[model samples]
Target: MLWGALPYMVIVFCITATIWRYVTNPFSWTSKSSEMLEKRLLRWGSLLFHIGIFAVICGHIAGLLVPIEFYHWIGLSDEAYHMGAVFGGLPAGIIAFAGLVILLVRRYTARRVRATSSVGDWLALAMLIIVIVTGILATSANAVNHSGFDYRTTINPWLRGLLVFQPDPALMQTVPMNFKVHILLTFVLYCVFPFTRLVHMLSMPLGYLRRSYVLYRRRDGAIYPNQNQEQQKERAM
Candidate 1:
């Protein structure tokens, strides 16, 4: 039931909740960065986490979305792909996990941040950690240890088919336990995504490019005599 129904259910919920949140409380849909409360750990953690996540996302897109035949046609063997996945994915996962730990610690240890953090924040962190850990386990078990369970054959088709409304639950029957767990957790993450700070991931800052320039001035209203004279001359002109 989970393999067949959960993905679609989560997709609908994610879309509905995201739209509801935007319509109801659009201004609250932000990351709510706590940089002012603590910067040192936040700086390192944010940088490493974002970099690792970008790499991990790219790796997933290549491994899952692109068919294995494309790699073969390009003169890339399965062994080469497996080795690259392990070598590249392991480090990226480790880095992201480490940064998440730092961020978690900072969130709890920093007095001001802890006070300001909502329950949703902690829930998001917990779900992210679970998903990342399971993903690492799945990647390590299959790619690093040579488990002979080529996910590209089974999982790839299942996932792609699911996207096109052609889910074949039988394909997941032969899949390993760790991979199944990772996939399930990912779907669960999507279910909770719209309610958490993860929603910020959907945002793009294109507005900043066209924003008006901000001008600053002294708080005091008093103007210098020479400046006043210059302003008056310009006004007269």
Candidate 2:
């Protein structure tokens, strides 16, 4: 398993580095255009995508950090958890998938957008789709594996340990190959975030709001000097 993941990790790291270089020097490209439609699409699409992504992250964090007892306390029995996983995860996945598809279609289908889009932009969208789709598959498969020594319960702990710098092959053995692929794709997306247009993910929406127009006025106004005013001034002098 370790040997298999090595190639993916290496590719992810390389692509990540390349993306970072471009992001840091985006201004090197002399030509760019801004359209209101594109701006609005980005604004709203980003909002939905960010909110949904945040929820997904929170769900993952909860699974990893929250104790089973805590879940039971909140009226989530193992059965409830399994059912919730299916019902909750499927719709969320579908929504995320839709958002990603819309963003991608906008990039390719819109002439103005396509003109300004870099290779990094398309690649970022593709990577996101890959990650989301794989996650959806993993979630669906997890429902099927609930009766057995499940991948999430057995393999995820090992992967978590690896993330924390402790690798365990025995625990990893429980993870299905497809699950590993999903995990790897996600890691690749993370590695690429700082380098691609995806860095927008890290930007503050408050900045957009700040750019919005605010009204203000000068306390005093000076009118332009016309011929009449000049003659009047001359006569007074």
| Strongest candidate by TM-score | 1
TM-score per model over all chains: 0.91, 0.69
Using lDDT, give the best candidate's number: 1
- What is the C-alpha lDDT profile of model 2 across 157-231, one tens digit per residue? 665665666656676565677777887787677676655666544435587766966544333322333335665
Cα lDDT of model 2 overall? 0.66
Cα RMSD to the true fold for all candidates: 3.3, 7.1
The lowest-lDDT stretch of 10 consecutive residues in candidate 2 is 217-226
lDDT of 1 by residue, 37-120 (tens): 999999998888888888999988888878878889999998888889899988998898888988999999999999999989
lDDT of each: 0.88, 0.66
Model 2 regions more than 4 Å off: 1-44, 67-75, 144-152, 205-237
User: What overall lDDT, based on C-alpha atoms, would model 1 receive against the true structure?
Assistant: 0.88
